[model samples]
Target: MLKVYGRANSINVRKVLWMLDETGQSYSREDWGRGYRATGEPDFIKLSTFGVVPVIEDNGFVLRESHAIVRYLANKYGRTDLYPADLKARAVVESWMDWAQTDLYAAARPVFHAMIVNAADPATAVAPTDGVKSWAAQMLRLEQYLTGHGPFLAGDQFTVADIPAGLVVNRWFTLRFDKPSLPAITAYYDRLSERPAFRTHGRNGTP
Candidate 1:
């Protein structure tokens, strides 16, 4: 059986867990890092030099990094769908996955810190107003991407692109941050939220 080590509430961890659910692949999970408090263990450090959550051991082939995990699973389990055999389609989907980590993280970080780490009491938090403003703008761009394709970020098929971005989208909707007009993003979020796997692992928006 595949095994995953990470805290359930972690955004990165949620990316892996939600992808597994979407792929319908069963795996065992252990709590690790940050809120779960197992990040510094020598064993975990051995597996991941950075000691991050979302380390997976699949038949002894260890893989770290949240995006890699989702992509690995998508390739193994969802070959023609989540991964896409067509080169162009695969490139399109992977671009969003990369964007989620690179571009999206800048917008997502402060908002998540303000809402989850400091607790949603804005007065006590670092005041992520600017962060949320930036996030909302990026989300508007994302909404345009989703709406342009109608339902999915790429097209009719739900793919690995949705896994990481879905995790971010859940936080964007749940955290009480001031957001710009986003009816399209709201509709897109509503569709993703309706998925059972999304609610089970990613929707709580705190980790």
Candidate 2:
């Protein structure tokens, strides 16, 4: 059985869980993150030197990083529909996944920390104005891509790429901040919401 180590509400961990659900893979999970077991513990550090959540042990193989785990599982289970076998198609999927982590996540994190985390402690709350502005700018890029691309990030089909992308987009919508109207992104969010796996893990309102 695959063993996943991470808290359920973690964005990274939720990516893995959503992928598992999409692939219909059964796995057991352990909570190890904020509000749960600390990843700094020696045991977890031994598994992931970076001491991050969303580590996975499959059979005798140990792996960390949420995106890598999702890709690995898709390949391992022969879910070609999610992770394409075609070189170009696979590259497209990988590109969007990478963009989600690098570009999209970069903008979303600060906003999330300010609006969600810091807001919970009023004394510590920093105005999310700047973060929201930057995030909105980044999202505008996404809106343009989706406008031309239509439906999914990697094109027409929903792929493994959408897991991380969807989660970040959900955060954009869920966070309490005034947002610019982005029609294409709104449609994309609606499309993602229709997916049962996404509903359970990506947009179930944990963000």
Candidate 3:
């Protein structure tokens, strides 16, 4: 059996759990982070030098990073729709995955950190409006992408690309405040909401 190490409420860990559920793979989860299974402990640090939640132990292989784990599972199971076999198609999906971690999260992190971790109100970007504008601007780009690019992120089919990016949608939509109206993104969000895995792990206000 596979072993997943992370807290249940962590958004990143939830990505792996959601993907596992989507793949119909059975795995055991461990409670880590916060007060439970502290990552700073020497034992856990051997698997993850960065001391982050969400480390996967499969057979004798140890891997960290949620997105990498998602891709590994999709490839291991030969789930072509999720990871794709065609070079170009896989590239397109991978592109979105990279973009989400790089551009999307970069913009959203400050707002989320301030709001959730710092317990500060962020109806707008509290200090500098740049973070809020940047995140919203990224969202507008997504709206444009989904305008023609959906029923899913990479295409009409649900893919691994949607796993990481969709979680961000949960964070954005679940956060209370006025947002620029994004019809296409809203519809795309509705599409994600229909997934059982997404509902259970991605969108239930944890992020």
Candidate 4:
């Protein structure tokens, strides 16, 4: 059985859990992150140098990083539908995944820090105006892409690309800030929400 280490509320950890459900891959999970076990401890540090959540151990193989773990599971389980085998098709999916992780996540972090993180602890709140502007810009880019490509991030098929993309979309909608009207992203969020895995892990109001 695969052993996963992470907290349930973590966005990155939720990515892995959602993928596991999507693939029907059974795994046991241990809480190891904020408000739980400290990931900075030596035991977790040995597994992940970055001391992050969502590390996985399969047999003797240990892996860190949520995206890598999802891709690995898709490949190992021969879920070509999720992580296509054709080089070009896979590249398209991976490209979106990369964009989600880098560009989209980069834009989201500050807004999340300002809105969600700061809301909990007033002492740490930063002005959300600038972050919201940057995030809205990135969202406009997403809106344009989704308008051009209707169904999923990687065209028609729901792939690993949608995992990160869906989570981010959930956050975008769930955040309690005034947002620009984005019809395409709104439909995309609804589409992703139709999946059971996504409902359970992606958009169950955890934003």
What digit string (tens of lDDT, one per residue) describes model 2 on residues 1-207?
A: 999999999999999999999989899999999889899999999998999989999998999989999999999999999999999999999999999999889989988877666567745555478888888888999999988885787777899989998999998887766789999999999999999999999888777
**Candidate 4: deviation at residue 36, Å?**
0.8
Give a tens-digit lDDT track for model 4, residues 118-198.
577644555488888888888899999899885998988899999987898899887777788999999999999899999
Worst-scoring 10-residue span by lDDT in model 4: 118-127
Segments of candidate 3 deviating more than 4 angstroms: 120-128
- Count of backbone collisions in candidate 1: 0
Could you arrange the candidates by TM-score from highest to lowest? 2, 4, 3, 1
User: Which stretch of 10 consecutive residues in model 1 shows the poorest summed lDDT?
Assistant: 119-128
Please estimate how well model 4 matches the true structure, expressed as its whole-model Cα lDDT: 0.89
The C-alpha stretches of model 1 lying farther than 4 A from their native spots are: 118-126, 205-207
Encode model 1's per-residue lDDT on 1-207: one tens digit a residue: 999999888889888898888878789999897767678888899988888888999999999988888888877875677788898998998898889878787788887877667666644555467887787777878877766676878778778888878788877776664567777777877787788888888776453
Instruction: Supply every candidate's count of residue pairs whose N, Cα or C atoms clash at under 3 angstroms.
Output: 0, 0, 0, 0
Give the clashing residue pairs of candidate 3, or none: none
Model 1: which residue pairs collide? none
Off by over 4 Å in 4: 118-127
- Model 4 quality (TM-score): 0.95
